[model samples]
Target: MQDKINRWLLDNALAHHPDQQALLNDNEAIQAASACQGNDAEKLAVFADHLKVSSQLIAVIDDYRRCFDMARIVFWLVAFLVGASSAFALLTATANHVNLMSVTLFCALLPMFSLCLWLGVSLLRFGQSDSISGGMLGRLVNAATHLLSKLMIAANTAPSVHQNAVFRAGRQWVNPWQLSLLTHSSWLFFSLGALLGTLFRLSFYQYDFYWGSTLLDSQQIAVFVQISFALPAALAGIPLNADLIASAQLDQSSIQTDRAVWAQLLLMSIVVYGIVPRLAFIALSQVKLRQSLKNLPDNYAYPLFRQALKRIKSLSEQSQQPMLAPRYPLPADRAAHTGANTIASIGIELDQSDRWPLIKEDTVKDLGHLINSQQYQSALTALESLEKPVDVLAFCSYARSPDNTTLKRLRNIQDIAEGRVLIVLCEQAIAESHQVDIHSRLIDWQTRAHEHALALVDFDCSHKVNVNDVLNAAEREQQT
Candidate 1:
C-alpha cells in the first residue's frame, strides 16, 4: 500500500518529465524493504513503533494536500456565487425599463472588478507554509538562498557528484508545503474568480421585479422604496461597475439596494464561517506546539562528559539484558580513537572512554559515503559512535533519495534512545519534515518519552545560518 501511494505520487510528479521514471521506480523498491517488518513481539513492537511514526508523517502530507484541494474548491464556489448574484440584479433592473447601458455596464464590470479586488486580497493575505518571506520578496529570497546553499555545499565537498545528489535530495524533501501553497493558492484565485463572473452573468437574466399599487403617494414612498431595494444594489454594484458614474441617471436604485444587502450578508457569512474559524485553528495549533516544546527535557546545561558516561552505562545495561539485547551488537573492544585519515573508514566514534573530537569535514564525508552505499547498519553504527553532540546532516535527491529511510531512522532513535539527539537539516531537505508532520509527531513522541529519559536537540538548520560560525561556536563550546 505504501509503495503504491509513493509510486502514485511519483507518477503524478513525473508526468511532465520521463527522466524521473527510473528514479521513482527505485524509490518504490527501497521503501518496500528498508524498514523492519516482522511478527515477533520485540520486532513487532519495534515495527509498530516505527509504523506509528511513518503514519504520522504520511497523515501530515495527506492533510496538507487535502486542504489545498479544499481551498481551491471553496474559492471557486464563492466567486461563482458572487458573480451570479451580480448578474441577477442587472437583469432584474433591465426588465423594469432600466437603461440598457447601465444594465450592461453593471453586469460586465461588477464581476470582473470585484474579482480583481478579491484576488489581490487573497494573494496578499495567504502564505505558503515554511516560507520565510510572505510575498514577492520571499519567493526571490528563498530561491536565492537555496541556490547559494547548494553551490556552497557542492564547492566544499569532495566527490562532486555525491554532493550534487545530496543537494537535489535536500531540495525535494524540504519544502512540500511551500510548493503546495504557491500552486493551490494561485489556482484558487484565478479559476474561482472566472467561474463566479460567469455565474453572475447567468443569474442576471433569471430574476425580475414586480410592482403593486399602494396607499402611500409616490413622493411619500420614494424614500422607503429606494432604501428597501436600491440601497443593496447600489452597494454591491458601485464597487464592481467601472461605469457607475456614467450610469448614475438610470433607475438602478432598486437593484443596487438589493446587491448591497446581499454583499453585506456574504461578508458577514465569510467572517463568521471562514476567517474566524481559520484564525482559531491557527491559534490552537500554536498553543499545542508551544506546550509540547516547553515540556521537552532541558539537557543543554548538563556536562557533555557526564552525559556521555550516562549514555554508556545505559547502553551497557540494555546490551546485557536478555529481553533487550542490542539488535545489532558492536564489537566488544573496538578502538576508541582513530588517526585523522582512518576516521572515515572507522565511521562514528561512540566509545565514551575516548573523547570524540568535532571534525566537520570528516563526519560529513563519512555520512555521505554510508548513505550512498545503502549501508544503514554501518550508518547506524557510525551515528551511535559519535561522542560529540553536534547535529548530523544528510541529503538525498528528490527524485532518487532515501528520505523515508532517513526519516524512519531518526524516528526510531528518538523513540528508543535515552539521550539528546539533534538532527540539523538544510532548508531544501526540510520538506519531508512537513510531509511527515515532524513537528507535531515529535512533540507527541517527546511527551510519551518524557518518563523514559530522552531529550531532543533541535538543529533547525533550515533557517538561514552562518554555517562556519555555527560549527566554530559549537566546537568552542564543546571544548569549554
Candidate 2:
C-alpha cells in the first residue's frame, strides 16, 4: 500500500512539469505505453520507470520512511524511560508512608482522564480528522518532522529532485490516525515500564500504604476505595474488604496493614486501566487508518491521466481504420496581411509530426516551442524586449489537454501583451474522426480562458490564423 501511494505521489509531482515526456526524454517510452492496454496506474508506472529522475525520487521516499520509523521508535523509548523514572520516584522508601491516593492519581486517575479527553476531542471533530492532529503528542511529532524536513532542505541533503514529494509523502504517512496509533502505542509502553519499575521496587524493599482526606471520613474513604478496586479485584481475585481499608486509614489507625493488597491493587490498576485501554485504542486506530488508506482518492480527471486515456482511445481508433493523408499540409505560410494584431507568433508544445500554420517570416517574429522553463524564459525575455506592446498569437495543439501549466503560460503571454494576447488552438493536427474529442477539449480550454478573461480562437491549418476572433471576443466582454 505504501509503495502504491508513493507511486501516485511521484506521478502527481511529475505531471506538473511543463512537458514531462519531452523534459524527461521519455517520449518513445510514453508512446509505446499509450499503445498498450492497461489501467491508468499501470501506464503511469511505465511512465515513471522511463523517467531519468524516478530512481532518485524512490530513494528519497525510502530515506524518509526510514527516518520516520526511527523517530517513532525513539519517541516510544523516551516515553518508557520517563514512565519508569516517575514510578521509581513515587515509590521510593521514605520515612512517611507512601500515599495510596498519590499512587492512584499518577497510575490510574491521571491516565484515565487524559484518555477520556483524547477520545472526546476525536469524536467531536471526527469529520475533520485529517485536519486535526490527535492531541498534544501528535502535534509534537508533526512539529519535529516539519523541523527535520526544513533542516534537510536547507542542507541540500537530497539534491536535483522535487523535495516536496518526499516531505508530502512523509506527512501523509504520519496522518492523524497514524499519529493516534503511535500515541496509543507509546502510552502502552509507558504503562508497562511503570509496572515493571513498581514490581522491582516492591521486591527490593517494603513500604507502607495509607490514605487520608480532611473532608472525608473512614466510611467514605472505604466506599470510594471499594468502588475503585471493583474491576481490578474481580480480574485478579485480590481480596478487598472494608476492614482492610479501615486499617490502612492514616487517621483511623496507625497499625501497619496488609502491604501485599495495596501493591497488588496498584499493579492491577495499571494493567486494567492504563495498558488495556491503550491497546484497544491502538487497534481502533489501526483499523481506521487501513480504511482511510484503502479508499484514498485517485483523480482520473487530472490532465496527465486524461491525456493518457485520450491517447489510448485515439490510437485504438487509428489501428482499426485505413491511414490517409490529412486534408491540409503541416506547414503553410499565411498570405501577407497588415494588422496591429500581427506583431508575433509563438508555438507552444507543438506536435512533432505536425507543423504550425505559419505567418510570413518577415511579418511576424516566431518564438520557438515553449516546452521547458529555459524556452519559456527565453520567450518572456523576447516579449519584454519589444519597444511597444502588440497582439501576440500563442498557438498550441488541440490534441493535448490544457492543464494549469498551460493556463499559466498563456496568462504570462497575456501579461506581456498587455491584454492583447490571442490563444490559437491548432486543429489541423487532429483527425476528422476526433471532432467530438476536439470540440470537448476546445470547450475545456475556452471555459478556462473565459473565466480568466483571456482572448482565444481556434482555426484549422487549411485556413490563415484568425486575428478577428480576439477582437470579437473583446467586444463581447465589453458588451457584457
Candidate 3:
C-alpha cells in the first residue's frame, strides 16, 4: 500500500501538467488505479502501470528505508552500551570472599529482576506498547534524523520539492516501536559482558564459592538450588548432592570444596536464567515488528480518490458503449451578445445560501435556483419553456467528484437548452493542507465535458472569472 501511494506520488511529481498531477493525488484516482479493479497484489501492479511511475523512484524510497533501518540498529547498539556499562558498574569486584555470591547477586540475579519487571509492565493492557526509544534513546534518534535532513537540505543548491517530500516521508515512516525488537538483544549483550568480566577476574584470582545466611542453613540452601536450577542443572549433568551443599556452606569448619563444580553451577545459572530466554523473546519481538511495519495507519487513506475513481470508471463505461455518447439534435445559435446577466446561473442542488457565481457582476444574471442532479429532467423541461435563447450557467460542487449521472444530466440540459451551456465548478475555500493537488475535481469536469461534447469549461470556483474569455467565445459564436 505504501508502495502504491508512493508510486502515485512519483507519477504526480513527474507529470508536467498541473491538472494531471493533481488528478494523480485524487482519492478517486487512487481507488480507480489500485482498487475496484482486481485482487490485492494485481490491483497495486495495475495501479503502478496506470501511473507509469518510474522504478527509480521506488528504488530511491527503498534506499531511504534501508537507511532508516540502519539508524534504528545503531540506536539498539547504543542502548546495549548503556546496559553493558550499567552491569559493569553494579557488579564490580567486592571484598575477598570464600563465596562469589556478591558477583552472582549483582550481575546475574539483578538483571533477572529487571527483566521480570519489564515483562510485567509490557504484559499490562497499555493503550500502546512503549518503544525502547521512549526515553533518552528516542531523543537521540530524533536529533540524528533532524541533523541528517537539515544537512541534506542545506547541501542542495536547487530545492526539489520531490526530494524534500521524500525526505519528509522518511521521517514520517520511522516507527519507534519497531526498533524495540532489540530490547532483549541489548539485555543479552549486557549479561554476556558481565559474564566475561567475571571470567576475566576468576582467571587471575581464585575466589571460593559458598552460601551463608543469618536465618538459612546449608540444607535449606541446597533445596533452593535444586528448585531454581532443576531442569537446566539436571540437563547439564551436574549432580545436586548433599556433600556439594555442605562443602558450599560458608560457616562450615571443613574447607574442602570442588571449586570447578561450584563455578560451573554459577556460570550455567547465568546462561540458563539470563541469556537464553532473552534471546527467544527478542526473536518474538522481531516477528511482531515486521507485522507492524506492513500495516499502514488509517489516516493514510487518500481524500481525492473518489474523483479519480469516477474518471476511471466513467472512461471504462464510455469505452463499452456502442456510441461514446448519444447524439443530440443540431442546436440553434447561442443567445446573441449574451453577457453574465443574460446568462441564467443555475446551481445543481446547491444550497440557497451558497455564495456561487461567487461574484455576481452587473454583466451577469442569476435565477439563483438550485437544481439537484435528480431534478435535472425538470430543469430541462423549464429551459425548453424559456421565451428566448439564453445561456445556462450550470454549477457543480467541487467537494463531490463528477459522476456518470452528472454527465447524463448535463447532456439533458444541453439537449433542451437552445443557448451555450457552461459548467462552473464550485468549491469552498480550500485549506492549506488540501491545497496541494486539489485541482483534479475541476479537471475531471473539464475532461468529462470534452468527452461528451456538452458544455464550456469555465475556471474553478476558487478563482475570479476572466469575463473577457467568455465574451470572446460568445463574439466568435455570434460572428459564425
Candidate 4:
C-alpha cells in the first residue's frame, strides 16, 4: 500500500512539478522513512497511523474500475463466443470434402478477422484520455436507436387482444419454434450438399442401380443433381433478398451489377448495421463510462474542510485572541510597507482575500447553499481557498480528530490545492499524538495521498488511543 501510494504521488508530482514540489518533497522523505521499517505489520502500522488521507476518492476510483472491469469481461466473453463459432464452421467445412466449401470458409473467416481488428483499434483509442466524450455521445445515440428499433418492431408485431391470448397460451416455455428453425436450416444445407455429392459420384462411376434405372435416366439424374444444389442456393437467397431491400431503402443508386451483387450487398449490410454497430456501441459505452468516472468531482472534501476551518477561525476571532500565532513572522523589509499600498493594490488585496477571516457559520451556510443548489464547482472553489496549515488541520480533526470522511475530504482538497498545505497538515496530525484510531486513519490517508501525489499529512495521534487496539476491541465485541 505504501509503495502504491509512493508511486501515485510521484507520478502526480512529476506531472505538476514546481507548483507541487514542496508537498512532493515532504511526502517522499516521509515515505522513505516508512519504507525503512522492514516488517509488513510495521508498514501497515505506519499506514494505519495516517489512513484518513483520502478514503472517499480512493473508494470512488475503485468502484468505477470494478464496473469497467465487469463490462470488459462481458464484452470479451461475447467476442470469444462469436470467434469460436466462426472457427468451428471453418473447421467443419474444411473436413467435409463438400463443394462450395471455399465459400463457407470465406464467410466464416471475414467477420471474425474484421471484429478482432476493430476491438484492437478501439482499445488503443480509448487508452489515450479519460474524457471519452465523443465515444459516450455515439453510444447514447446507438443505444437509443437500437431500443427504439426494438420497440417499433414489437409495435408492428403486436396482435389483437384475443389473438395475443391464444398465442401466449400456445407458446412453448423454451421457444421450441426457434430451435426448430435452427435445426431445419442446418439440415437443409447439409442434407442437400450430401445428396448432390452422392448423385455426382454415381454419375461419374456410371452406376446402374435399380432406383437409378427405374426412377430416372442420365439426363434426368443430372437435372436432379442440379436441382439439389440449386435448392440450398435458393434458400440462401432469402438473406440476400433482404439485404437488397435494405440497401435499396438506404440508397437505391448504390446497388450495382456484379456477379454476386446480392451476396455483397448482404455482407455489407450485416457489417454496417449488425456487426459493426454492435461492436462500436460496446466500445463507445466503455469509453464514455470511463470518462465519466475520471471526470467525477473529487471536490467532496472541500466543503466539509472549509466549514471546519471557518468554524475554528470564527471561534478564535470571537475570542479576540489568536489561538495560534504564525510560526514565522513576516520579513522586516515587508513589514515596513504596511501603509505603502496604492489604491490599485488595495483593490487587489480585497479581491484576493474575499473569503478571509473565515467564519465557520457563514462557511457552513455557504456549503449548505452549494449543496442545496448542486453548485459543486462553487463549493470546491470555496473549500480550496482555505489555505492556512492550522486551519486545514483543525478542519480535518474537528469531529473525532480523523474521521474517514474528513480524511477523504482532505485528500480531495490536496488534489485541488496541489500545494504544500496537505503535507503540513499530515505532519501536524502525526505530532499531536491523539487517539491511535485517528493516527491509523491519518496514516492510511497519507499513504494513499502520497501515492496519488495528493499531499500527505502525518499526525501521530495514537499515543493514548491505539487505533488497532480499539478496532480489535470492537471486533471482539462484534464476534461475541
lDDT of 2 by residue, 184-284 (tens): 88888888878888788878878888877778787888888898878988898977877788888887536566888888998899888889999998898
Poorly placed runs, candidate 3 (over 4 Å)? 1-64, 75-99, 126-180, 195-207, 210-232, 241-257, 290-295, 298-300, 315-480
What TM-score fits each model?
Answer: 0.23, 0.61, 0.47, 0.24
Predicted candidate 3, C-alpha RMSD = 13.9
Which residue window of length 10 is worst by lDDT in model 1?
Answer: 344-353
lDDT per residue (tens digit) for residues 375-402 in model 1: 6566656655655332343222222232
Q: Scored by Cα lDDT, where does model 1 land?
A: 0.35
Report per-prediction Cα RMSD to one decimal: 21.1, 12.8, 13.9, 22.9
For candidate 2, the per-residue lDDT at 353 reads 26
For each of the candidates, give the backbone clash count: 35, 0, 18, 37
The C-alpha local distance difference test score for the whole of candidate 4 amounts to 0.32
1-480 per-residue lDDT for model 4 (tens digits): 434433232222222222222322233223322433354334333332233322322332233334333443443444444444443343344342222223322333244344445456556666564212233222333344334433433434322322222222212111222222222222223323332333344234322111122445545544543433243344455333333323322124343333243333223333332344444444555454444434433321233323333333333343354332212222232211112221000000111133332222322212212112244456556655544221121112211223334445545543453332222232243333332333333545445444434323223332322323322332342233
- Decreasing lDDT order of the candidates: 2, 3, 1, 4
Candidate models: Cα lDDT each: 0.35, 0.66, 0.54, 0.32
